[model samples]
Target: MVLKESLLELLKIKAIANITIKELCERADINRSTFYSHYSDQYELLTSIEDEVLDELQNTLQLYNHSDKNETFEMLQRIFEYMASKKDICQMLLSDYGGRNFQNRVMSITHQYIIQKWEDEQNILKSHSEYVTLFVLSGSIEVVKSWLSNGMEDSPEAMARWINDFTSNGLSCIPKNENSRLK
Candidate 1:
């Protein structure tokens, strides 16, 4: 925790470009070797933080699936709610805001969640499925960006309804063949 806090504080000072493992260890009062024992490098530490945040987000999403009737809308609500709770971490992650890499990360995670739920868990989505996953990924990124820019004043349930209604005719409910017809 000390080492993590030390690194986070340093990140606050400047972009990761200016920080060094030596300084991180010094601030944490941990041995340089101890830092190595825990994390391979500074990049590893950053990636670990991202993983930790993503795990929390995924866990919250899982809770929405516990009841069959409450999955989709609840999942959207949970996403905004959970992201609101981790606002600082998100602010750190999105500092560059909407960069290609960040967009890719969000899309990849959303796709993974959909695949895991509709395909792997229930064995429903086709083995060759790419169309729906891509649609959901693109749509979700756009939706999230809008919510973030708006300050997200809407309640999670209302956000969920917005997502549900938008997606109703947008992607999830549409057949893959219909998707091909669009483009």
Candidate 2:
């Protein structure tokens, strides 16, 4: 655990690119042998940390996946609450300093979930489902990243409410007949 703790602490102040295994071992007060026992390199240690966080997030989201339609909003609220509880780590992983791979992984997780939800529904986005999925996933992730960047100024419930509202009403806000004009 010392290695993970040390890596996280180092990540807070420095980008992963600048972090070396020797530095991590020094900060962790562990010898190179001990570090090598756990991870072969700095990148391996960093990835292990990322895998743990993603696993936790996936588990949390899975808990709400089977809920009833009426509980959708509540599920969203709980998801935000879960993220809030892990704000420090989430902020670090979602930060600009966080590698593009990590950010893309987060989006991929969300995108897959949305796709599953759509599959479970009777009336799904029959038209351009791929684009719609990306639109929704990207929009949601951006909002979350912005919230985390602001140090999560709003309560999780409040942020969830805002997000849910936007998602629920966003379609109606778009001009329904815009396609006709293009023709």
Candidate 3:
């Protein structure tokens, strides 16, 4: 646990490629042998952390059936709540330093869910489903990144509602301001 926490902390400041085992060991307050016994290298340790999060995300996705709109929204809220609960690790892993692999993995986990939801609720064409899914997932990822970067002042429920509204209702769901450029 200490090693994983230490690696995540280091990731906040530097890329995984630049982080060395010695530094990680020092940060974790353990010797090189201890780290080596658990992970052969920094990348392995990082992968371990990513896998843990991915597993939990997959499990979370399973908790909701997505059979209805309300259930879908609840699932999204639950995901955001999970992210909030693991703020530090989520923030770091979703950041630039964390690399696209983790983000891609996350998208992969949620891809089927999003695709099924759109197909059932929106009646989206099968041929266009991939594009639509990509667009929504990309936007949702950016929203999560922004939410994490902003210290998550809003509650998870609020974030989930905004995301759901934006995706389901499009731009109309977002209120316009006179000073805003959307108009």
Cα RMSD for candidates in order: 6.9, 5.4, 2.1
Q: For candidate 2, what's the RMSD?
A: 5.4
Which candidate's TM-score is highest? 3
lDDT of 1: 0.67
Runs off by more than 4 Å, candidate 2? 65-69, 120-122, 125-127, 171-183
Model 1 residue 182 CA deviation (Å) reads: 22
**Relative to the true structure, how large is the alpha-carbon lDDT of every model?**
0.67, 0.75, 0.88
User: Positional deviation of 86 in candidate 2, in angstroms?
Assistant: 1.8
TM-score of 1: 0.64
Consecutive 10-residue window with the lowest summed lDDT within model 1: 94-103
Candidate 3: RMSD to truth: 2.1
- Residues 107-178, candidate 1: write the lDDT tens digits: 677676676666665566576446767776677666665666577677767767766765555546433575
The C-alpha local distance difference test score for the whole of candidate 3 amounts to: 0.88
lDDT tens per residue, model 3, 104-124: 988888997778876887788
TM-score of each: 0.64, 0.81, 0.91
